[model samples]
Target: MATPAAASDWIRYWDEASSDYYYHRPATGETSWEQPDRWICGEGYDSSEDSARRSRAGSSLPLEDEDDVDAPEEDLFVVRASLSGPPPLPAGGPPPLSLGAPPPLPVAAAEPSSAQREERRRRVLGEILSTERTYVAALQTLEKVYMVPMRMVADAGAKVAIFSHADLDTVFLNLDVLLKLHARFLERLEQEEASGHFGAILSGAAKDIKGCYTRYISNYAQAEAHISALASKAPDKHRYLEVCKSHPDAGGLDVRSFLIQPIQRVPRYRLLLEELLAHTEPGHPDEADLREALARIREVAAFINEETRVLEKSLVRQGRAFVREGELTKVFLFSDLLVYGVPTGRGYVQKGQIPLGEGTRVERLPRTEHLTHGFAVVDGHGKGYTWHGESEAETGEWFEEVQRAVAILAMVARKTALEHFTAAKAGCTLIKFNHRDGRSSPRWVRISADGSAICWGDTKSKECKSMMALSKAVALMHGAKSAAFYRAQGAKKDRDWLCFSLLFRGRTLDFAATTAEGLFTWYLALAALVGPRSSEPILDEEALRARVAEMI
Candidate 1:
């Protein structure tokens, strides 16, 4: 047999062929191959115009290119025969026409280009987008799945407030603000990726976020108190708890943990931005703005960290029975206070709060009821409260946690006192002899190293007074010009005495150092803190160390 025409040659012939075309009308089993004006499928066309019109009406597919217009449209369907074999010879006529194999199925794109990997600030911005999406999801979970049901109960005139409606509202409101704001910022960041001006844009966005979080951070304590109140005092708290337990989204969550996520998210900016800054190259256009943003974000993070600590310490585990009250009372153990409340759906109706402090005491109570676990806490007032947990282990845990919280509060109170002194330039303590209110009798005084304040009570417990700022104290220290000012006067004077008088808060306060070296030690410490030559004026531990070294 003569060599069959190559497939390309047959396809070329079909490409140039006119209206005389044929197709296998599989449905009707008929072909009108003799009619030049009729498509082989029994669809007749007068001209290309008719075919084009029908194509537009969706009756037939339209030709993709003008070159295929003259080829009878039905002939395209005849090309579906497996291309594995050559087209048939068609009984000694020209090789049968065939449409090119159907275009290869399009390969789906990998991942969307918008979500592709990014670099530098752009990558961090993408992270921001991702985290913001997560934060919004969390907010939605709390608001819709948890708070919404509680709110519905409240609206129905349920006297028992399941949660602190006000606190949740505030948290939800602020969280929504952050969520929506971040979303907008994410959009801007994405849109401006190629602009290279995103440094300023990102800085502005960070500042706005910090600003928005300011209220939430500042009011964190109140929010924590409210949450504890609601969890403890809400008469319908169990109902709320039941709902939370049954919630598909919140079943495994601790309400406090879920609620604190938003609080925690605020401080995370520093970490995220620091990473972005670390990756950013020096002298880059965004470097300055990124640095500034990092500074501001760090400041805000520090503040938020402090507030977060308070919130964390205020956490309460409720629904435990009170041995004293003979019923279950919500127990909120805060850093500085322990509160008892009745649970309501809206919030806890606080029965009372006992200050937790150095004076407070926690002890295990005798487990009288086999069903109950017990502990006793003596608050700062020395008033005793006995409570029960579900088990011995549970009550022990409560005691430990409360004791730990109280210890932390004690440390914090001390630190706060020192911080107050540090701010006033009197952080360091110096043992000296002093007369109370200028009385003749001299007693050992712990003069604030900066001489800004004085304390003269027992070493175990002392009262501190903010006499003046360090600046004024410096002037007073210099203004008093007498060796006797550094030495005790009268017949009671001793060789080790170095006395000084400070006009503190318009009252003359006398101080006498024990020895010459001790006098200079006190002098140098105060001078380092309040003196004009002092580089580090705060007289903190490092400053005190440096000052003592100078005296040596």
Candidate 2:
């Protein structure tokens, strides 16, 4: 066996020029291609001996001490023989070589115990309580710092310079009611939290929360608009607001900001409840209650979302107008439909509805001998009905609103059409309809994958027995006359309610739906495939699907 000094002298170094590892014996000043034996490579060397060896051979790779070199001697030889040069050194130390005990297996992160989760849930509940206190305090500031002062002034019948009493009422609509509602809400939440069983506090307040928040959120837009108008058009109002904002009790937030706190608070409750629910474990005492509360909050959120969507697609214009010199009518033009109704003591009783789609038309007519400010609406069947506005401006406004509704309706129709056509192309278009030829069972119909034909069969059959080429097909929802004809042909009375006809190659195929809505839906699907193509760019299919969902 080599002596200790000679063993320490065996330095392993990588040669860059030759791309191989070589061992150098400093004692004999000899370098060789062969790896030295375990004894010569310092199998029993200490740190100090290895350090001394490294100090002497400054440019060579450091030798491992006895504790570091855990690999079998033969394995180390095999690793070195296979490699062209010394392996890359890892950041922690030299390359692992079956190293001592293989470094302890990585310890997985410990999962939070039930006790820890309970602690986290309590902490979240505490956060919610603290935030509620802060919110209630803010609402109080709005009530005390602004609303009370303004109301007192108005009640004294003093000349309030900045804004009218009505304006103030509009700007702070239902705010006091909301403050009282949330104060009670906060008290109940506090009671539950104190009892260490914060369960269903929100669900318990579901009725008041939904009613009050819906009223407040619906009127929030009017409140904001009133404030914005005052700020821009009323200098005294703007100065008064600035002065009130400087009050110490205002906490650096303006009146508008304080007013929005309730709006913001609603959504914050949702998030906090969700976080608390997450930290809560199954079968915990609070779990069921917490879930119920979350559901109620989510219901409120959904109501708000739906109301916003409806408001977005609300009426464009509505007013009194004469229909072809008929009885005075209330005409309401919406984004996608035109509705006319008979005026009642409270509101309008709806009389009729016309969908403003591809075949709908509106035109301004020159002042007629008997009708002033006259315009005509040609229905999808090319029949014209005239209306007279109260004045030229009213008539012009009606014309413009009708034109806008028509354009918007057309865009929506094109998008729906493209979506239906694409779904049919993907072999997904399937609808069930009753045949007017006295078939006892409803037939399943689908547009062909290439959108060239319509196929029909019973649901029990895997294959369609009847197919019609759509290239020359025309689909129309049946009018009263056509329904009368179908009824005379021995169709059921229910068939007269939701009947439509498909005319192709001089042959007519009549179909009916169980419901009137189903009649319109089927007509729309068929019309989309067979209707004249639109000039607008194709809409994204996913976006169209979402749009359809919103419309629904």
Candidate 3:
């Protein structure tokens, strides 16, 4: 067994290395790869003719080293500065190069000694079987010592069942799913090992695990509610506790803790697969299967990340029931608001409303020696609601979900403020430029649709500001011409530069970008701002695409 720190290190290795994983959208029917050493700048870019030739040849751009195939998946968008820099060339031209076929695959490693590799594989299988057996034992303990006794007590006219049946159902359902899946896998794995057919079974391990994880995550919300209720709402739970505590087979463990074991075990698949991959050689028959499984399991982790993101946006599905202030409360979490409701004679009734914003705060409280899952939510007026969860996992989810929702609210507030400022000034588009109107050194300048451009000194110690009335301001892009900037050179004869001029009243402002793509973006944004409201100020497809591309 690894120490806690060692376990964390293993998980972090996969999490951080996931940057190399890229998902190809299915609809585009297009795929390409970019090497780290390549650049998008003029000197580093391939010629248009070469790009066209590659397209015609049906070849993908060189990808990262194939050895990284088992690395975790990457995000759809990467946030970083451009990798390209000024090329080593005289001002007039670039150096010649002979571009050829893509690089060959890396050489495979020398095979490990037979006995050592087989022993490692056997050890990995043993670990899997051991964990699976431990998990099965935990589930059996629940069914035998806990579930069976609870049913007996309920039959004897106790009110304990009323408050606990819903929770019991949830726990039993999820446990059943896990128990059957692992039991079958354990039998299959043992048989395969005996028959020396390990490759066949291991190949499909990831697909099977992926199916299980999908089901588990689907029931995550329900499981959380059930565990919370069991821990906090069970009436005279000491009766059931004494029953399980005194049982010979039971280890006197808290049932809530026992219930959370399966949830914790879900991520353990990644750890086990990592160990397996380390032992399997590149040429091993099971290597492809292991890689495929790793990728699929990584998808499961990715799904969790996305689900958390959606929770941050809003609780699209209704929130689960949580006991608050000694009553059942159903809380709906939205990016901008939280609505609390309680069961009433007629139906559920709204009990309170909390507007989450700049002033609202959600905090996780330090648990007491006895309570392991305490949290608090303080409204803008200082009114607070304290709550408890059944287990550490449940409590952590609540804390994170609320925090993410509040973060989304704060982000939306900032976005709204920016939009309002732009609307107040009747400006929609803005850009930064290096201005050399009169200063000896280039000054950083910000041009806005308010018919103005402000120039600031290198350290912003001095300022040059200009603005024009909306009625008189008009913006337009002009063709590139031979001109000397403060420090930049004039465009060469073969090169195309993007230059735009802003005219308002009697004053004029100029801006330039190095690439046509950027110039076109600025031109379109400015054109949209200056044009009449052909329809409305609401975001149409074009506006939405731009906003999503920029994120602000």
Candidate 4:
């Protein structure tokens, strides 16, 4: 046994039973089988004294002098075991050791070093290459077993009863293109991997990858629909597909299953690249390119998702309408949004979108001297927009669709609001709000857990500074802003727009939130306490208080 070298954190100990050397860090209570590099065996102490002590103890192990060792500093501390008991433990004693196996390292002490991170990055990159190869093989299987055979049969001028040439084109639309695109992509990835430049290859092929996948995914719905139709309507095609599943290359999957591979491939690439990027160091050469390639693939995947959402939405109506005098626009009424766009040579350029929600309003307007077939749409903020159509029937159709959409949206919103109110009433909801004075920091306001009272306090304080009984609160004036208030505070109208007031005991308390969602949650929780009159008659300060008091 030997004492730790001076100024070194590592303590070297000889285990007599196993005839092995072990190192321990007293501060972290970590034990390691490997000798720490910082331990200089005989630097701060007399080497001759140490050797004499070991000799007196009947130890046969030889201690190497620092001058005799020609090894580097990292290799200076070599493990030599002596048949001696363990070294004396420090003040509280060393952590218990089994000596049969190394102790589990503490999580805080086990952070991966730079070398470990680099190794992990290499492993993740290898995964990306391997998965891409497999994906390309799947695409090839689709083409060779399903696509090419159908085309060859059609070309032979035989009676193509299972599928028509037109059907083949629709079902296999752009799949060949996708196969070729991924095959080339896989080739490039392989070459880059071989060259030790795996991450740099994706940025160069982003354009082709995006374009091919975008085309393929957008038409994926039509292909799926065609397959579904054939499975139901044509038994012969179904039997043919059942037989195609038996092909060795088909891997026991039908045409539809193989068709879905291209759709899944882009997202797979995104996930693999994300994993690799996570392990890559910030300043590593491949970091920027990995990020860029990930962004491109993510963009393509997002486009496909948006297209899917649009396809799911039923188009209520779309036609030409005039928003202002001589400002004609193409308006599309979807299930949830009113999209107005300017018509271009190729298509429409989207100009704006109005979300249809609980507060939306649609009404018919009387014909004016300058405008005919008129209707008006009022948004959630009480702002009105007028649109005119060429004929009265067109205007009527638009008005009906807008009203139906608004009604449906309001119904859904009420259901959701009720659910939120129920939850807020059952449990505590906390929201932080900034004062309109702009000097005080934000404060945390919360409904009591029992749902009996509302309280306000500093952010970190455990106890509330002020409390008011929920039963005494008379009104919740939401969006209670005025021109005079903005002028007095020297603030813009949109600033603190989610401001509200709670009236209790003929006194008003003002609060404002940075986000609309926070305001809505507070409003719902308070409304659940005080009843529906909390939201009635959003008016000026004086009038709102009077109205709320009257309702009470």
lDDT of all predictions, in order shown?
Answer: 0.47, 0.55, 0.46, 0.57
Candidate that scores best on lDDT: 4
Choose 2 or 4, whichever is better by lDDT. Answer: 4
Determine which window of 10 residues in candidate 4 has minimal summed lDDT: 316-325
Candidate 1 vs candidate 2: which has greater lDDT?
2
Please list the residue runs of candidate 3 whose C-alpha ends up more than 4 Å from where it truly belongs after superposition: 1-119, 151-167, 193-197, 203-206, 230-250, 305-323, 326-552
Q: Mind giving the per-residue lDDT tens digits that candidate 3 earns over 415-487?
A: 2112232332332222223233311222233333222222222212222222332223443434332132222
**Which is better, 1 or 4, measured by lDDT?**
4
Off by over 4 Å in 4: 1-111, 158-161, 314-552
lDDT of 2 by residue, 321-369 (tens): 1112123367755445667888789977888777677589899888768
- Per-residue lDDT of 33 in model 2: 52
Worst 10 residues of 1 by lDDT: 7-16
Query: Tens-digit lDDT track for model 4 on 1-552?
Result: 233454336545544444445666655667665546543232222244655755774644342222211222122222224434223323443332323233334243334457766777777777677666666777787787788777876676656445678878888988778777777878887777855566678776666788777887777667765565454367677677667666766644566656655655565567667877777777888788888899999998798667656655523211111121123377756445787889799988878867777488998988879887888899988888888888888778778767766664553332122234434443332332223333223445666543446665434433343556665566666654533234334333553445666776544555665544455556644543453223343232222222323332
In Å, residue 243's CA in model 2 sits off its true spot by 1.9
Model 1 RMSD, rounded to 1 decimal: 36.6
Candidate that scores best on TM-score: 4
lDDT at 129, model 1:
55
Model 2 RMSD in angstroms: 27.1
Backbone clash total, candidate 1:
24
lDDT tens per residue, model 1, 188-217: 766775664567876887788678877766
| Residue 114 accuracy (lDDT) in model 1 | 24
